[model samples]
Target: MSISERISALVGPASFVVAGGLSVAVAIFAAITIERRTIEDVETVLAADGIDWVLVSANGLQVFLDGTAPNEVARFRAQTGASAIIDPDRVINRLDVAAADTAAPPRFSLDLLRNGDGIQLIGLIPGPGGDEAFAIAEAIADIAGEAEVVNMIESAELAAPETWDAALAYGLRALETLPRSKVTVFADRVEVEAVGETREQRAEFIAQLQQDQPEGVEVVLDISAPRPVITPFTLRFVRDAEGGRFETCTADTAPARDRIVAAGLAAGATGVIPCTIGLGVPSPSWGEAVETALEALARLGQGTVTFSDADVTLIAAQGTAQVDFDTVVGELDADLPDVFSLQAILPEPETLASTGPARFTATFDAEDGARLRGRLPPGSIGQSVQTYASALFGADATDIATREVADLPQGWSVRVMAGLTALSELNDGQLVVEPDLLRLTGNTGDTELVSRLTRLLTEELGPGENYDLDVRYVEALDPVASQPTPEQCESRIRAIQEETKITFDPGSTEINDTAGEVLDAIAEVLPDCLHVRMEIGGHTDAQGGEGMNLNLSQRRADAVLNGLLARGVLVTNLTAQGYGESQPIASNDDEDGREQNRRIEFRLLASAEVAAAAGDIDDQPRTRGGILAQGEIADWPFEIRPLPRPINPDGE
Candidate 1:
């Protein structure tokens, strides 16, 4: 029946005015009857449709719903049922739809791209203290120079992330490191696409971005710097008694450079950079030529290869086989790119009687007299060297044993003088010079000295001489190794780690600033413990899903490992392992217990030098087939240390 007809039967028609004519008893009875009928009809429809959570009411002909509905669909269903039984205009739905269950926040991100002309901010960023816009503008202004700013950013009013401040700070800070970059900033992830001015700068920037980012920020970096203009396209490297060095570095591309550097590293070259890939590259075949040339140089093992554009000079050391050198040089000459020409200058082997490359050797202690030995070319060149040495070592504190030699290589005097100058920078180290060879051995406290001198020597000695720096870093001497026993190493690590636990921000893998200090201390001691096998283990409490916790734990473990590597820990000695809720040490039912379980551990896996120093934990050696098994510890920095004899307490 229509609501009007039902009301008419119960009380009266809509046209009937009850203000003065209707009795109170009659109206009350009508309201009660209509309400009962409405409730019954609503319940019947709700049951048929499988919808619930709505209460029906009636005031005379008007019907009302007053209860919480599971959702909008349920509220609509109840209203539809009442409208069928009564006038549609008189049916009212007061049912409240239940609020939605909270879910994880979306990854908030935006990319701010700046170029030569102007700046364009793109992506979504949450308002942080309402200062994000200003921060972005200021950071861009600092780097944009005179370029105009274009704001294309859109923001939303959402809950701020716990690490938004840190993430924003880091992203803004990148503006200084990266002159031109497309920085994508998310609440948890920060990605950068940038260009560096030089290879060194590029590498340093990448290292800084990846290492020890604040807690709750995942860093993704792609930084590249083009190869600079190499005029004459010069190149030189030597391997001899003095050690090996590159007079200058050249690489047409990063991959080419990396391959070249890898070859050098394999051949024991340290602190060397390959050629950049920009201006003055003779041809696209530059990398190929470098690869073949480096192979040949590695084979020679003791010579200098200088390639200035097409002219390639191959100078062999004393015992280099003439036939082998000629064969390799011939192949290179024939196969080199059409734009390049090979000039193989193979000198006859040196005899003892022949005055070889001017020799310069200085042996001096800080407090005692010094001995300057070896030969220099004749005339003013020789005199200038003597004068420089005298001034450097002191006239009365020095004894000169060098003489003018015949037919020394051109600029031999300059190299000798430069060698002497470089030697003076060392506190107490030996510097030796030979034809195409310069070997430096000494101890210094300055870690920066190695890199500085590396570049300095390359510039002074012409980018084609062989140089070896055996300069030991003495930590006592502000600079920098002995292989300490594994026990001593592991104990030292644990001592620094015991008081502080490596914990991550809530649901984040980033290590906070405070935890980085502990990591720094760990890095300092890892050099001594290179012989020890260590595992960086991550664990979690059973709260979230098993898969999620496992993934989180794994990511956190990797983050810690990356952190240690950033702090200068040897990568070979460390392994990152994540054991999620599977290896919890405490109950997951309580917050404190869960916190205990959500921790990172630095555990000693195994070590060769076990008995040298007894640590708090008595770890027994696990041998396989009566020998040290090829396990995880033997991966890198491998060593077989003799177990030092244990001394009796009474000195027996």
Candidate 2:
């Protein structure tokens, strides 16, 4: 064979071999590039979808997702998200879901007691430390005049129930307001048992409590008023020139009280006269004697009649006919029960000078205590009066300055003692006494003080006597008026929102059922806050069109307003506004940020004038139906039209 022919054959075969090696290298490089691009794309897609926990990598055509997912749904979500960037057949999910949490939340409870001694708190609280307990102690100290707090509260390092904080807060507030109370607080309810000074005060306390109640927590209030015990069981009726009035009235039973009251009314005693039914009664026939005496006074046409225990006294008025007085007194004395004794007097009319009929005055005040500058009868009567005054008005509180009078009156000692007793009932007032007239004028925190004084004075002075009363009720001194203000109510609502949000369904304006408690808590507080102008602001994330977001937010705000209305909150002071994508508390790029942006916020609006001037307030209807109508155009997918009204033929 020739040399050239052999070289050419070897060259051709080597070239073919080199070409095959290059082809194999090119194919390998292309495979590596495709795998790298696939991995990058899958990872980018997973991160954007918030599936970063499921890590992405690729082997040739196959992409592997390997990491611990939060749950089965999360794992599936990560796989599906990754598949969207590539092919589902080429993706392998090696993700394991984390185990479900099994630890139980701790039960929270509180017991608060407030009395003359001070305040006591015993409870269980959930926390990472004892800060919550410390806050409670500090709050109690501030509210109760540095009152001693026996905080036996224990702190547990566990998750708290949803309503624990709110219930505890309400219980503490109750303890602060009520002077003598026992409050029990659980995660979901609060029970209050308190003593009020009057029936009106009890009602006021209930109203205040119900107004400031937290959402979802139940408030049970059992308030009571202290009943005054009548010492002498007295009744008095007088039919003088000023018409008939009961200076004081008392009965042992309801039936007895009704009978006595009826007799007073029949005798022309004006308005609703309160007859105190107390522990002491002189006799079972006390009502009978009182009725007979009142009827006798009414028939006599001019006189005063008084009943003190079993003793009955009838004094005929000046100018009453002597013959008429004798007949009435004779009948009353004869008709009286055996337990009762009668004193009948037809006083002789006397010409008096301008000194007001030998007047004596006593004064009682919260700031100055009690002072007596009154005339007393001769002998030990003066000393006895001083001693009696000291006992009834407290020794430290009483100061007596009196002059002895030989001829004071027939029942002068009785009148002095009765005046002092009546004076003691006033928080601040004065008592005036004369031979024939008794007068009391003052202001009291007690709503029933006038009735009580009347009962005491009537029995002491006898039925046909005359007396005047001028008492006023002061709310500042009233314990029942210690209620949370509008500012405090707003602060409480803000605190509640901080702990837990009023959440809604995903991508919808409908409130979530889990938000029931939150809504309830807010509803309870709204009545007190009604005096305060407020705005319910609805906000949204930057996930949708600006118009759609605006409309959605407005609807959500309306929904909250409706929720409060359903819970019996008056909406006159409330307005709803939608900020939409305009107000972003956090960046809208992340799930948590978006979540924070999508919220229902309660804001105290400026005065109507200010809000209107600033143009922050929108022109929308306040009613539920009208508000719903405002959103109809934005919420509905189709166009809305108003129905045309039918026209009459003659335009009548």
Best by lDDT: 2
Alpha carbon lDDT of each predicted model = 0.67, 0.73
lDDT (Cα, tens digit) per residue for candidate 1, span 289-387 = 766776777776677766666656666666767788778777767776677666665655567755444567877666675678878878887888888
lDDT of 2: 0.73
Q: Flag regions of model 2 displaced more than 4 Å.
A: 1-229, 352-357, 362-421, 424-428, 435-438, 455-652
lDDT of 1 at 88: 90
* lDDT per residue (tens digit) for residues 359-416 in model 2: 7899898778888886888678788988998998789988878888887777878887
**Top TM-score model:** 1
| Model 1 lDDT at residue 584 | 65
